[model samples]
Target chain A: MSVTPALDARREFESLLEPVATVAYRVAYNFTRNAEDAMDLVQDSTVAAFRSFDTFQKGSNFRAWFLRILTNRFYKSRKRGRVETTPIDEAEDVFLYRQAARAGLLGNDDDPARLVLDRFDVEAVEAALDRLPDEFRDAAVMYFLNDFSYDQIADVLGVPVGTVRSRLHRGRKILQRALWDVAKQRGLVHGDGPEGAGA
Target chain B: MGTARRAPVPKDMSCAEVFARVQEYLDRELNPDEVEAVKAHLDYCPPCARGFVFEESVFETVRLKLAASACPEDLMARLRECLEACDES
Candidate 1:
């Protein structure tokens, strides 16, 4: 069944906005790591998406298309000095590693004690996330936490699907290695036990 | 004393290869053969297993933290107001 041109376009646009808005906000939050910045980015992206509604092709993945707009807008405004940049590097890594390690060491991970300490280590993970490079952290959080698929991520970032896969693959590896190192140092995992220095 | 030559995990079995299947593993998207391979590798290789565990934990932690940091009532209200303003313009 063919849809009436104007009516179909409007309906399509509205439908797209509902689901995409939440995803956009989540992605923005991951990118900015601040409520105010995320809110602004979402708002700006929404308006821009509405303005360019005609350019969006029907039956295409709207979520990715809209996200690409949001990401571009974010970087443009960021370049214009609207958003603050958090430089992530060795210094940030060292700080986060130390913090998580100390936190892990102090938290009781023993069987019975773990029941009480599970909540505390979430903060440690957050600190580790804060240490990641902005793009890696942003993409990782969006894909893993927000549940956007690889194709959607590619569309959002205006890159090829392979690039998204590589970014996520690399981003996850770095995060996993960092967290494991911290966990090992903190004694969260018994490396020297039957697991034997790796587990 | 000669250095012990560790058995190779197949150069094809780099951390990247193991990690690529991780999401699939978590989502139960892998078929039997792939699942078996990943599981077998994890069983013998503590480092890879630890890495997987770490990845899982990070995902869990981020999910929890994001849930906890949901936009407060006032913040949501403010965001709605801003959205409405954008609509009017």
Candidate 2:
């Protein structure tokens, strides 16, 4: 198909790039699980998106379109094999929910600490996220963490909407378990028996 | 173990179900009946309530962390280089 002139397309793409960069980085980080990989993914996706700018329908979700390209690139590069999946057992699931509740209760809106990240073990949570399988992790990061709607996530992943929901559900379950395990070990949470012990 | 535990909630509402609907509740997407069900469940179940709390916290944490970890100076230079190369071709 005939496309916009290269210079004009580049200008338009440049204008859209900055606003979407943070979201793109978040999506790439979730998929690749490393800063280096995420950077490469964003760069490659940007180039590819710029080249195909003609097909990108105007007035549509640009972030989702760009993410779809990035996620597709990620899977293509993974032709070697799929990552190992970590399953969350039923007991761990229950404990995770309980701990999440307690954490919520401790921090209130009036508390200044609530607004800051000082007390929370963000590093621990990030560590747990790093261990998730690529698909679920990417889905969770894009949908929940990035604040994309389910339809947006589906568009970005180029998957059916139902698959997006399924990945998010499974991903959240895994994260809940992982976060509990990490927090319990670090003593960030109390009264939750050792990870997997209560279950 | 307490009066809250003894209260009756809808049989359809399990922790998983409540967890799934947490996002809906936050977004105000739940209908009156479903909202009531989730509210009643949250009222009785500490774990489910905690789970929602953690979810919100993690969500905020992820957002802040991502924002803080912007494209580094070197990465921005590299990106500029890549764009320049693309323009040349």
Candidate 3:
């Protein structure tokens, strides 16, 4: 029945930590592109977080504070990765939809967003992200995956919101191109609507 | 086609402008007038409309896919152990 303050605090910390761990791991994996490495990063950062936990203001943003540590470790240990700045024209896949519409493959009945969901899996999506440079990938993961606001992302990335916006914008274009190809290759382009895509 | 009478894109928002700011529009980063301009453009521009849909899907799918990946049990155990060690220190 002898519970120390440290043990009680540990219990409190773990309670808050458990829910966000999955997301923290996922974000770490995105950075390292290796589960083992991601685990290491998370383990190291969690230890760091615990040491500094006393300084953490109650009711402040734990997720953001912890993520900043994780990202800092990643930057320290991670090798340089490529980040693409695709030309606006090359990044867009509107031609595919336009072609689908013209061929009657996609008509009023079809929802392109729904189609995208059905076509791409987690691996395909991750591969596309891998193609992005490290900074853009981090921003995209934070904004899209973690649902961080642009300002939160900027805070984590140590940049202005404008930078986060540009990175996300560019990241989306690359993803669109990659995802469209997956959809086509999966034979989802059957143009099965009342209008014929091939016709 | 009743839509044939309409212009290809919004008179106010050019294709270039829409293309440049499409992410901002989707992110709700645009102002009221700017949002209206993008909306108007989307109505008339079929390609941009298609692009917009796919972009939306990509955004949502990334969130869903990544969020679905849970931390491995071993890592969680390790983290707990690490924190326990911190308590002892």
Superposition error at A141 for model 3 (Å): 1.6
Docking class of 2: incorrect
Residue A121, candidate 2: C-alpha displacement in angstroms: 4.7
Off by over 4 Å in 3: A79-89, A93-105, A182-199, B1-11, B40-54
Better of 1 and 3 by lDDT: 3
Cα displacement (Å) at residue A125, model 3: 1.2
Q: Model 2 clash tally?
A: 3
Q: For model 3, what is the alpha-carbon lDDT of residue A58? A: 93
All candidates: CA RMSD (Å): 8.7, 7.0, 7.2
How many clashing residue pairs are found in candidate 3?
2
For candidate 2, give the DockQ. Answer: 0.17
Task: Count clashing residue pairs per candidate.
Answer: 1, 3, 2
Candidate number of the best DockQ: 3
Of 1 and 2, the candidate ranking higher by DockQ: 2
- What are the DockQ scores of the candidates, in order? 0.16, 0.17, 0.32
Q: Which lDDT tens digits does candidate 2 get at residues B21-48?
A: 6754665645678888988889999757
Per-residue alpha-carbon lDDT of candidate 1 for residues A1-199, written as tens digits (9 for 90 to 100): 8867655554556667775666677667767767778888877777687668879897898877877788778777762212342442222211222233434432433231232125347545555565566667767776755567777667766777667666665565566445544555576653322212232
Residue A24, model 1: lDDT of 71
Model 3, span A5-111: residue lDDT tens: 88888888888788778889888888777778888888888998888899999999888788877777777877433444343223543444444454455545456
